[model samples]
Target: MEVLRTPDQRFAGLADFPFAPHYLEIANAGGPPLRIHYLDEGDKDSAPVLLLHGEPSWSYLYRHMVPPLAAYGHRVLAPDLIGFGRSDKPAARADYTFERHVDWMSAWLTALDLKDITLFCQDWGGLIGLRLVARFPERFARVVAANTGLPIGGGKAPLPFKLWVAFSQLVPRFPVGWLISKGTARGLTAAEKAAYDAPFPDERYKAGVRQFPLLVPITDAHASVAECKAAWQVLAQFEKPFVTAFSDGDPITRGGERILTERIPGTKGQPHTTIKNAGHFLQEDQPARLVAVINGDDAA
Candidate 1:
């Protein structure tokens, strides 16, 4: 697999993203070992709080939430999945797959040997992270499922997601920053918007972005359908603490949290919330609230 690593300069001076990059080399399904980049901050010995970002975005999505989480004395970890951020980006759109992503990140987890984890997963983060939880249930202590899901293609994906899948494929340009702004309730500043665009120097660097939307299983014939079904069987047995914090305004995932609160045995009696005035990217719009949720101070 031919891979493209974004030049280091594009990431310079990214506003509110000051953490130094840390990397780990992990074997992939094929080709050379890929380098996965992550931000490891705060007390190294403390239990980990793993934050996973989703499509067309990277660890930059969690910048605001990181400082507070780290300062609260938890080891905060945020990784830029391969093909996004400073991580190696495979050249072809066909290089990315749902199973490959799961494997790559599974490798990352085993590499770090992280335990007692509190996961904050959004978008594709949940798609992949939730699978990890089902497969490695002992590694996690609790979970925060924010605006994401593990779909098995048993039914049609939400209409907005379907529209996004079509748009991502047919659109003339994949505007990463503008796409992020459109998803946030408060939107982003010019600099913050630029930060989101920093990972992709040009269109060629966006193969992962271009391919992510199509990976969602909106039909029974999709590649990862059976895998997600097996994951669901495992998830139904995941009895650890589970909670959902979905935004009130996201058309794409507004009602999707019920899938977790209803299915996960651990979600029973947890004070799951619907964050008001937020959109698909709740971390951007409600970082403080998210932090409070993480600290277990969002009571009432």
Candidate 2:
């Protein structure tokens, strides 16, 4: 598994991103350790808020939310999933698998020995982050799911997602910045778009990005179908404080939050919100609302 690490310089001068980078190397099958990069801020003693981003994006996605959460006396930690952001990128698409993704992050999570976590997961973040919760339910205290789901490969994926899967594979140049901008309601400034593009210098670095959409397990034949099903079993029994903060403008995950609210016992009395006027990347569209939800702010 030949892994490529993005140059630290690419991340320099990113718009609205000021946190210093921290790294941990986790074991990789048939290869040397893989380095995962993350942002650690706020009071170290406080129960941590774990922010997970999804396909084609990185911890940079949480730039607007981190500082406030940290200031509110919460430890905020956002790791770039392997093959995104400052993390080591596996060069081959075959090297990226849904289970391997979960394994990689699970190792990172346990390595930090982090506990009493409040998770804010979006996109593939939810796919992977929720699995972490299922695998180590004791580590989490609550969850905020946004624009994401834990698909068991039992239902037909919406048309928008099917189109996205096709686009992720067929596009000549994977447009990381453009894709992120397109998923947000207010879109991104040129610099912000460039920041999203910072991780991948060229096509070779995008194997994980290109492969993520295809690994959604939308069909029963998908490899991770059984694993997701097993994860769902754990989620169905999850009684922690779980809340949904879905946005109204996302076509791909529209109404997806219902599955969570209905299935998870934790949703019984928690406040679930629809971030109006925001798109898939509500972190960019409504970061404040997300922060408020994470903080349990009544006004949110």
Candidate 3:
């Protein structure tokens, strides 16, 4: 697989993103090892709060929550998936796959040997992060699922999501920054939008970003449909403390949390909240509430 790494300079001097970058080499069976970048903050000895971002976004999405979570004496970890942020990007869209992502991240999890984890998963983060929970349930202590889902290709996807899938494919130029801004209630500042676009210098750098929307197993014929079905089997039995903090403004996943709360045993009796005046990218719209949810604050 031909791989492309974004120039180190693109990430320099991003506003409100002062955390240092950490790297790990993920071994690819038939290809050169790919580098995955992450942000590690706070007390290393404390149980980890793993923050996983989604498509077209990176660890930058968590800049607001990381500082406070770290300061609260919890270890905060946010990793850019192999094709996003500072991680190595494969040149071809075919190199990006749902199973490969799961494999890559699963390797990252075990390599770090993270245990007693508190997970905050949004967008693809929940899609991938929830699978991780099902794969390694003993490692997680609790979970906060936001604006995401683990689909088994069983139900009809929302019209907005269907429109998004079409748009992601049909758009001539994949505007990463503009796309993220549209997902949030308070649109990003120009600088913030540029931060979101930092990883991809040109269209070639966006093979992963371009491929993510299509990877969602929304239909029974899509790849990983059976895999997600299997993961749900495990998740249905997961009794860990799970909370859903969904935003009110997201059209795509507005009512999606119901599937999780209804199916996953872990969600029972939890403080599931509906964050008002926020959109799909609730982390950008309401990071403090997310931080409070992660910290188990009574007010959350």
Candidate 4:
């Protein structure tokens, strides 16, 4: 593997993102070194909360909620999935895959020795993180799913997602960062916008971004379909604590929360909420509400 790491200078002076950077090198032979970047906040002894961001976004998405969660006495750890944020970016679109993503994150979690973690997963975060919990249930304590689902590739995907996949491939420019901003409800500020743009110095670093939309298993014949079905089997029996906090305005995945609430045994009694006014990027649009849900403040 030709392990590649993003230059530290790229992330300098990210406003309000004060957490120190950390890294883990996972096995990815015949490809890039697979550098995973993360942030560890609050006391190490406190209960651990793992914040996982989704596609086209990074740990930067959780800047607003980190401090408050830390203040409430939980150790918050947020990681920028490989190819996003300060993590290494592979040069080829084929280099990014569902199994590879799951393996890379699983290695990082193992290397960090994180156990009894409470997970906060959104978008691809939920897709990959939920698989981690299902595959390695012993390491997790609870899960909070927002704007995410576990798709097994046997059902029709929402229309918006299908259109998104088509547009991402057909578009000539593929403005990765700009497209993310537009997906959010209120958009981002100048500084925040700059932060999202910082990771990719050029289009070459966006191979993973461009490939992610295509990698989602949208049909029953997809490669990862069987594995996802197996993961769903594990999740079907999951009897721990699971809660859904989906936003109301996300056209792409508005009803995804129901899958977890209905299928996972863990979600039986937990309060599920539909956050209003937020779009696909709920962490950016409703960070305070997200935090409240995680802290059990909004339970009825």
Candidate 3 lDDT (Cα, 0 to 1): 0.94
lDDT of 1 by residue, 1-300 (tens): 898898899999999989999999999767888999999999999999999999889999999999999999999999999899999999898999999999999999999999999999999999999989987899999999999988888687777888898899888878899999999999899999899899888888899999989898868978998998999998898888898899998898877898898898989988798888898988899998988887677582
By TM-score, how accurate is candidate 2? 0.99
Candidate with more favorable, higher lDDT: 2 or 4? 2
Clashing pairs in 4: 3-33
Name the 10 consecutive residues with the lowest summed lDDT in model 4: 1-10
Candidate 1: stretches off by over 4 Å? 298-300
Candidate 3 Cα errors over 4 Å, as ranges: none
**Candidate 2 error regions (>4 Å):** none
Candidate 1 accuracy as TM-score? 0.98
Error of 2 at 250 (Å): 0.3
Question: How close to the true structure is residue 110 of candidate 1, measured as C-alpha lDDT?
Answer: 90
Off by over 4 Å in 4: 1-4
lDDT of 1 at 226: 91
Pick by TM-score: 1 or 3, better one: 3
lDDT score, residue 205, model 1?
86
Q: Between which residue pairs do clashes occur in model 2?
A: none
